[model samples]
Target: MNAYSGHTYKFTKEDNTFSYIKVHIKTQIGVKNLTRQEAVKLAGEDPDYLVDDLFNAIENGNYPVWNVFVQVMSPEQAEKYKWNIFDMTKVWPHKDFPLRQIGRLTLNRNPQNYFTDIEQAAFSPSTMVPGWAPSADPMLQARMFSYPDAARYRLGVNYQQLPTNRASVPVYCPFERDGFMNFSDNYGADPNYVGSTLLPTTFKTTKQGRTFSTLTEHEKWAGEVSSFTTEIGHQDFEQAAGLWAVLGRDPGHQDRFIGNIADHLSSVTYPRLRVMVYELFSRVNKDLGARIQTATEALIA
Candidate 1:
């Protein structure tokens, strides 16, 4: 499967100038998909099919590789773009902003210890390098806060101190000390207060008089500053309709998709709820919605 960074991120310079970018990781082996029937069979017979496949490939030295590309959008371009750059649901068209190859990622080795390496592993979008930063995407902003909070809850307050999650570079934040399972030196007699000249600690300083990029006047005025509400409109179904049109280009794809939807939808006992589901898809495509309703009713009958 092709991996995409749905959220836009900023690539900042030491001077605080930044470019917004979306990352794409395309598999070198190409994309392959199984039919619904095949997927169902494999799900029952070999529930761990995908994980086992990757592990075996790495064990046998047949490493899987993915080519990484980034679509960079300058701040000026972002301001004038047709679509909002910070919208997570929208994508920057390649025709307008082509992909630039940055690097390759290879799965060369498997985890030695599942519990220590895999189970204890904590992943958060907030755990980024100096040059990388998050954009104003609503979902991304929420995830940046929520994911780290989840990791703290799951692995304890000192989760960052765990071997698997610890940063390779030395971190010296004396303020964050003496939590449960804290096995570090605990900053050894250094005063926990900031700007303590008595201990003489060195901290990274930002470039003198370098101003970071700020939101434009239009962005600040246009962006919402209220609680999220479930407001539906015609524009909400535009992307789904586009995807349905794409599936139409592939032979039997649309039919299979409808069949898959019908199968699950038939299981819903509440008639009113089933009608609501059909209505939601109808907003995407009228014909597809009708087909799904027919197929689902036949199955239920």
Candidate 2:
């Protein structure tokens, strides 16, 4: 997820001059893994096992926590950064930009009602507040619009009116007058469209090039800040190489990554798909490519 925000994010000090940053969250207990065999068995026999484990832990006052840390890169550094910071698959190497401890995240409370609180809950990327904004990552930008559009369609236009989705503070809206299932007095007949003389709206000064007014400035900011999709380059593999090295630090992780990928590749059955997968991985690294090909062939055979 931190890979999605690789742009040099802003950091302000006492004097107000700022630098850019990226954040990483390392769980205190470290990452846990399940073997392919174990995962398959669990999925068939106990699909909710993981959820039960989390709930039981919190109920017993054993909260799982993650140490949040950030990597700082100045605007000057970002301008001259080797790889495009907007790419989601790439990470800012920790050696170049070190982690600075910021805070901790704890899963303390479970939802009271799964349907009302969890199932129906809307998690829009546009939900972000000020000081914390979205970067130019294309995937992130897409999610900002896509997630809420899904929620509004799935949960109705007044989905935000749900007890779980409702804002804690008084949410004032002059434009959202009515919809299919509106319940908020329809904004007392204020024109849903602009040019209303009764309740004059105050529009914020937005980033240049945006034409959509219904969306918040933050949503517009996300689109303006990102890079367009284009051709791939060697730099894409650089961070993957570093990640492969990190995966090697753990026993059997590198093997598992290969075997796991091979297991899926075997399911493809098509010779062309297998060849494409092999070629792609080979481009990532020669050893990974060869191993994946070997493992995949063995599985298929």
Candidate 3:
């Protein structure tokens, strides 16, 4: 059972030597949860509770950080993997592909201007430099197109011109000339298209002679995209069941999950939707679905 928005990406080197990779960020502090009662109390008493907690920690020099991880399945591995590597919902089990910690991202510095710095900053997967690339997760592939389209609309075509979103190094784009708020001398005398003597482009080459112009059949997936459907059976429930088993290992997590879901599901007046959710859960574990259904019905009544 796989659940992923299939998006395609390529990871390339200076000589255009590349591999396919999917990236994940895990919080160093691990996941934390608060009860509904605690959340309500915090909301009524101190709406800025989370922000305050974060600020206090940083100010006291207890910086929060995240562990950067990548689930790197090579082209060969991707072809023979049990589950679809492109599926987002299906996680690459750490047992098989253990995490390789590349670096830490610390939130040590707070922004001086929340608007110009944080609010106006445009983050897009497409903004990645040469080394990092997107994977063949459909959702990720779609975001590559959607994100920049949004940035262009929301912050203008020259959104990259904004100080917060601008790259540290200079960016050249002869084609991106004459948009709203156009201030740059748009590539002075460079040619926009290829085969121009005005500005000839030379690509970097590796010692082994691999150049940027080379393309492999495996890299492109044979041009036209294909759509295929698969049957979902026990494999789909395996992960959810494993999650339930782990929750059982913890004395109260299963109850907590049921209670949390019930609290929100009770507000949804549509009975059929509630039944559908329970039916979906029942496929994973009969007891869990029953427990959640009972709790949710009681809440509604």
Candidate 4:
């Protein structure tokens, strides 16, 4: 599967200056997708088809590779951009923000143990190396907290102590000790309290003034002050309309997309709700909404 960093992030330097970036990982072998009919057949016949294929590919030495690229947007550009940089639903057009090749990722090996390596794995967007930090994306901010909290609930409080979840570099947090499945020496008699004189702990040092960049006045004014609400407007459908135009360029792709959506919408029993769905899509494109409604109603009948 192709991987995308939907949430924008920051790449900071020792001077505390930063640039906003988003990552794209494209398969080196090129993208190949199964048709809806083939996908359905495989789902029923071999539920673990994808996992099996990936495992076998690596095991047989034909490792899957992905070319990694990053799209950078300066803080100044973000402030003046027409679209909100923090909106995960939107993307930076390649013409404006070109992709810069950063690196390659290769799935060279399989998991040694399913339980230890695969089952116990816990990942969070908040888990970042130095010089990397999160942006003001609302959904990303929520996920950063919720993901780790979920891991704590599902994998126990000391989930980070697990082999798969443990950081490669040293982490010095004595306060976070003696929880469920804590296998470490619990800091080995080190003082858990900060600014302890009895037992001193050395922390990894960074350059002075290398703090995460502060939000601009515009960002500060726009973020996190209102109660949550579900509302829709014409502006929201602008991106959807753009996507429809993109699909139109791909010949039968638009037809397949409509058919796929109709197959799912046909199962909706509520007549009013189905109408609402169609109306919402109508905001995207009139023709698209009409086609979907006709196809869905035909299937339901």
Candidate 5:
């Protein structure tokens, strides 16, 4: 199946020139889906079927691969886009910005040990490479902080020192030291803070274009500071209506979409909550909302 980062990020340069991007990883093998009945049966028979299949495939030399691509839009294009470019839920239409293949990702090996290789692993959006940077998306920002915080809570303060999470390249941070489980030399006797004339810290400056910790000058908004949160309006449902129309192209896809909603929604015990759901879907399409309500009521009755 294909995977998406589902959050807007930035492809940036040292000069502060950046383009908004959404990362996509398309599997070499086409996507396949089972109906709700089939999925429930499979879950009962073998809950770990998908993971087992992936591991077996890799062990048998059938390495799973995905083509990594990015949909890019210039800063100018973002301003003119129909939806807010920073909205995580809104997908940038492919017609406007097509996929550009960046690289290939392959899974060739299984973990040697579950505790060391799998359990200790940690990943965060903030741990980005030089050319790649984060955007102003609220969800992305939350993950950038929450993911690392969760890792630290689950693992330890020096969780990054673990073999699975450690950086291969040299990292120079003299201030971050003496934490629990710290395995390094603790920077020996280096100065914790750098402001002395006798000894100077060799820091990577802006001229080298390596200072990616914050947004560049052009990226910052020049207005008064205010917190941002997405507010729903009728316009918010337009893209959803478009998607419902697209589902009609495949004969049973629309039915499957309705069924998927009904199967889960029918389990809700609260009648008021169900009505609220129906009203939400009504914004997308009246027919869609009616169909979902009928199917759910049938299951409930």
Candidate 6:
């Protein structure tokens, strides 16, 4: 299966400039999908079929690898783009930005202890290195805070101290201390704030003499606070309609797409709800809405 970082991010420079980016992780072995019928059958037979397949493949020395590529768009290009660059619904078309191969990921080892390795694992967009950071996409901004906060609630506040989640690079933040399940000595009685004359802290600086502050100039743009609204319109469905057209290239894929939706839409049990769904699809394409309605009605009948 292929993976994408749907959210927009930034590849930043020490000068506080950045290029907006999206990540793609494509499997070396081409994507293959089981039909809905086959998927349903396999799900009932063995729920862990995919996981077992992956584990056995790795164990048998067939390490599955994914080539990591990034699509980068300059701020000027972003400004001139037809669609909102920050909109997660929209994608930077290949012809416009193009993919650049950067790295590869290989799943070579299975977990030694599932509990320590998998269960305790935590991830957040806010956990970024020096050169890479998140864009100001509203959804991305919300996720940066929400994901870590959720982990803190589920695991103890000191969940980051866990071996699986701990940062590989040394981090010193004396201000943040005395949390639940704290592994460290809570900074060992150091002053609990930055710029303390008693215990001065060193801030990493780039060769350009810019201190490594989380706040970038792009983020700290000179602007007064203002209310914003993301109003949905016909433009919102343009990319979805484009995807539907792309599916037309593959035989039965479009029909399967409609059937997949119809299966669930037919089970909604509310006429108004089903009608709303059809109307939503109508925004994408009139034919798609009619096709879905007919298929779903047939299934119900």
lDDT of 2 by residue, 1-301 (tens): 1223433345543233445567777878866768999999999999998899999999898998988888876656765777656666667777898888989889898889889889888987677433455555567667889998999889998888788888886666665556676776666755667664765456632234332233322334444545555777776677787788888997899999999999888999679988998988887789999999999999889
Model 6 regions lying over 4 Å from their true place: 199-210, 220-231
Give the Cα lDDT of each candidate. 0.83, 0.72, 0.72, 0.84, 0.84, 0.84
Instruction: Give per-residue lDDT, candidate 3, residue 240.
Output: 86
Residue-level error in angstroms, candidate 3, position 192: 5.5
Worst 10 residues of 6 by lDDT: 220-229
lDDT of 6 by residue, 134-221 (tens): 7778888899999999999989889989999988877877656887689877778666675747664566534455655445565533
Residue 297's lDDT in candidate 6:
99
lDDT of 5 by residue, 64-159 (tens): 999999999987787667777777668988888999999999999998897999999999998977768777777888899999999999999999
- Model 1 is weakest, by summed lDDT over 10 consecutive residues, at 213-222
| Candidate 4 residue pairs that clash | none
lDDT of 4 by residue, 120-206 (tens): 899999888777877878888899999999999999999998889998888777778887678888989666676746655444334
Model 5 TM: 0.89
Q: Cα deviation in Å at residue 253, candidate 1?
A: 2.5
Candidate 3 stretches greater than 4 Å from native: 1-10, 13-18, 189-195, 202-216, 220-231
